[model samples]
Target: MSRKLSPSRVTSPASASVEPSTPRATRTGRRVLAGVVTSGVCLCLATVPASAADVPPVVSRGVTIPAFYTPPAELPAANGALVRTEPMSLGLAIPGLDGRPMPGTATRLMYRSTDSAGQPVAVTGTYIEPSAAWTKSGPRPLVAVASGTMGQGDQCAPSLALEHPLTLTGDTVSVGYEALAVYRILATGAAVVLTDYVGLGATDRLHTYANRLDQGHALLDAARAARKVPGASVTAASPTGLYGYSQGGGAAASAAELQPGYAPDVPVVGTYAGAPPADLTSTMKGIDGSALAGALAWSVSGFAQADPDLRAVVEANINDTGKAALKDASTMCVGDALLGYGFTKSSKWTVSGKSVAEVIAADPAAQQALDKQRIGNLTPAGPVRVATGVHDDIVPHAQARQLAVDWCRKGANVTYEPVILPNLGDKILTNHLVPLITDQGNAIDWLSDRLSGKPAVSDCWSMPLQP
Candidate 1:
């Protein structure tokens, strides 16, 4: 959730910008809702529980809670064929509205796989298998995606876009960044893999901060998992393509870079990353003074979950109220990241020693801690296509540019494409990331082409970032 690339404005010549991740359940896209009611974007529906004990597993719709989660006996070996069976059971909400909003639960289809923890994990996503009763082509392409943000819980959270009350006059579900992109990838003759990411949909206490290794492993694992479907087997690594924006962009970049080392056998060809937050520190500075404080708060909390040191740093900096707020902040969605989002709106969160900022600023040990979470030093295993909005305020162009510059220098074969988004005005600093909403189709198409084995136009020149 704290992983918005925050590129102010941008696009790639190979492709324009497009976003495919979101708390997508309620926050990542940064729009509280997709409706036109508000002037700017809002992070959409996020789940909130009536109580903290909302951790039951397999809450089948209209049935008793299956059981409290005990890690699965073992993840199914993904080295098999693909097929669809009945959807697995899930419970989303409790019927009473006694001051608590309930999210409904339903059985969803999933592709299962293992993780670094060797835990049996699964992803509930969509795809059109040509081999199924619905195929016109032979061996459809595969598109595996890692979603952006969805508040970090299974039972409670906001509604997805389409289901959100903030619907702007559409019956369509506000598909999240990954879900939305899955459709695009599928449209291009590929069966997509939507990785809901850890701590969301399933798993616990994980949502890497643009951590490429995590993103790559999760995405590749989904591919192996896909074979678990009723009639599918990815016997050999097919010609695969990757695309993502914002958090997903980071995931795509991460997966692309880690393909050779981590998922060595997974055949990954072309990769497209739109408005990725390649540079962490730069992104934080850009959002420090914006209304996007909500995004900042979510990212910080999520970051803490992944990097304990950072969490301790944050804990030391803030006061009791700040601590409570940060705790609550982790549970918030874009909507709640409102006018005076707890301490984010207050000047205290921005200040030091007396607050979380001070804790970070004063911590001598934090220096070493901070360095671990920093991305951009790694290189990709294949051709990577990258983009940014020249006018993005949320993810400053300078940061994206710096990231591209950094990776290029590190010898990653990056197809770095930079383009300006005109309609996205210059006033609001964050409106930049918003372009992925209105101005990012090309980026999606570029990825499709790359995956299709189309050659990309990449340049390695260094570009200076603005002070």
Candidate 2:
């Protein structure tokens, strides 16, 4: 039996018709690129039942999340403990020429992980066991995939995306854009585990978007939990790799750094962190008034959820408009955000008409909380490939490059690749997203080499000279 969300939870201001100031040419180009990518994947619009028997569904941003996402009352003491698992459906697969299904089988799972506040939390994700054999030298490798900016809503969980590649309900829109990469990885006979982060799928709390500790722990714990899944091919000896872009890139990079002490048992051979949002201060400023401007509210809401000091600061300074925007954005997915708040300015949400970044800059406590989310402070373990588009103004190119630079200085083996492409459009997401599509093949090959025991050649010695 599915339960309806409370009236308070369902109310949102996304219905207001507000269009962004993007030029028609830029919008057309973006749509064409997006369509080409979507069509290429042969995405199916079929819907699977989102509820389990005797478990009530939870609603977020007007979308119904499966009951399997509900956490048990008492969690295990250890991190990465398996809470539950259910067979999942993949929307991107087709009947292969050989009469076997393309890609592989999927499992929707919930696992135990620690939050940014050091509290026990449930993280949801999907695990794909490839049908293809591991042709490489070692046993079947596992790649822990962290999705780019999906959103703060529970419905935006990547596990849910495996079941429904595209969701278009009233006022809510979500696309499983990561399916392309996941299917490709599966084709290589590598098992893929996709983390939904700390709170995106769990019913207990709101998603702590981009919280370094929360996201990093969730990702590493997913890798840990994947090995424990019943009948899974992945084992303790499996070579693990971390893969992500944009917000996911930060999480993967954070996991790589945190794995040395957090979960040294998970053998992470390599990490591909593309266009990581390493510096929140820079990223927040870059995202403001951009196509995905609603992300500002997500960052603030996430920080507030993890830090009480930041929450207090937010409550004191946010105007009614800001409060409404945050409330609305809390339930939004990336597509909903794009439609509802594209090119929206953060200055409108503040009491003093200052952007969220400016407000955080003024407050010592808020600045400190955000500083804690910064990556590149610690050296990442194992080989890490950091790639960024030279024209990516969304996450910003310089900060992502600086992460590789920081790791190189720390004596970590780092391969830094600068993707030089013509600027598609400024602040329209084209400049940021195009490189992700263009550089994805190279990134995958780089990680595959490391997984095959090929030593990575570091370009740290020449990084200062190139950029």
Instruction: Tell me the TM-score of each prediction against the true structure.
Output: 0.68, 0.88
lDDT of 1 by residue, 1-467 (tens): 21111122112211112333322232221221111112222221122222214333322111121222212323345521222334332122234344322221222334454433344444334333422221333344566666554433232121132123232111111223343454445455565555655444433333333544455666776665554555443334466666677777777776777677667767776777777766655565555556555556655655554454565555445445544455444444443444345224424653353433335546666655555545566777677777777777666676777777777888777766676556455435445556565545676676666656667665775344322
Worst 10 residues of 1 by lDDT: 29-38
Please, what is the whole-model Cα lDDT of each candidate in the order they appear? 0.48, 0.80
Best by TM-score: 2
Per-residue lDDT tens digits of candidate 2, residues 11-74? 2223111123332211211211122122221111111222344344555645766677766656
Which candidate has the highest lDDT of all?
2
For model 1, what is the alpha-carbon lDDT of residue 139?
42
- Model 1 earns a TM-score of 0.68
lDDT of 1: 0.48
- The clash number for model 1 is 72
